[model samples]
Target: MLVREIMTTRVVSVEPSSTVKDAALLMNRHNIGAVPVVDGGSVRGMLTDRDIVLRCVAENRDASTLKVSDICSHGAVTVSPSQNVSEAINLMATEQVRRLPVVDNGRIVGMLSFADIAREKAGMEIAEAISDISMP
Candidate 1:
């Protein structure tokens, strides 16, 4: 199956200039860990819960004071919505990242996660392989 087939269609994104606190609130509200940063319908970066905790909170930086761009992972690894699940899974493993921002025509389309992929199937082998590389 392709990414678009299983990926969440209702994506939640943030702006680069959005504050980390705002992002955090959104994540909390949506019960998500990361959000893609978009500008003019194009992806610029991604802000994960790890980024906020490690880059902002760990450094004594105020979440409300810091912008998503300040701590978001720039030049983020991405996958096309049309790509197959295995390919997306491979990209996540190779990049040592849990989440991938799906882009189409330079715009954010959706987001995929190792967890998302794992949850897509109940195969123990596939889940174990992906879970091994995923960070808590």
Candidate 2:
């Protein structure tokens, strides 16, 4: 399986210059924890709910006036849509990240996550006696 098999395609992104408050609001409305920060048609960073709380709210910075570029994680790790699911999973595990933005042809096309793959794999009822039901 590949990330393109289960990644969310209707990804929502924000400009790096967008205010922190705007980003948070979009996340809240969509019930997402992060947003890709784009600049001039390229992904520059990733802004998560934690960034808002830690960089702005917790630091006494006004979210209304703070730019996402100032608080977002710059040079975020990214994944290619054509890569195998294992590679994407390894990247996330190594980085201790929950989500990975998918890039295709120099464009942000989708986002993949650990839970997405786990749930997909779990849903397959391939064989009744494939293996013991116990873990070693």
Candidate 3:
């Protein structure tokens, strides 16, 4: 199967200049754990709930005052819509990431996540990928 076959198409993104609080609000509203940070039509980074907690909240920095770029993880691993699901899974394991931003022709298109993979019920592959991603 291909990434586009399982990736979530209704993805939400935030600008680098967006406030962490605003990003967090979007996450909350969407019931998602992360959002890709885009700048000038390119992905600059990814902001996750954990980043807000550890980098901003736990650090005692005001979310309203901080930009998503200030706390988001940079150089995020990405996948193309045409890529095979197995290749995408390998990337998730190698990168220790549970989600990947799907880009097409340099444009943010969708998001590939464990939940999407789970729907495939690929069994051992998913288990192994989860184990690798969970490694400390």
After superposition on all C-alphas, the RMSD of every candidate to the true structure, in Å, is 3.1, 6.7, 4.1
TM-score of 1: 0.85
**Residue 125 Cα positional deviation in candidate 1, in Å, after optimal superposition:** 13
Q: Which lDDT tens digits does candidate 3 get at residues 16-101?
A: 99999999999988777888998876888899899999999999999998999999999888999999999998999999988899
The lDDT for every candidate, in the order shown, is: 0.86, 0.83, 0.88
TM-score of 3: 0.88
lDDT by residue (tens digit), candidate 1, 1-136: 9999877768899999999999999989988777888888888888889999999999999988899999999888889999999999888888887888888988888888876788777677777876665643
| Candidate 3 wrongly placed segments (more than 4 Å) | 122-136
Order of candidate numbers by TM-score, starting with the best: 3, 2, 1
What order do candidates take by lDDT, descending?
3, 1, 2
Q: Model 2, range 1-136, lDDT digits (tens) per residue? A: 8889989888888998899999999998887788899876578889998899999999999989999999999987889889999999889999998788899877888988655765677654532222222111
Best by lDDT: 3
Taking all chains together, each candidate's TM-score versus the true structure is 0.85, 0.87, 0.88
Query: Candidate 3, after superposition: displacement of residue 99 in Å?
Result: 0.5
TM-score winner: 3
Off by over 4 Å in 1: 123-136
Clashing pairs in 2: none
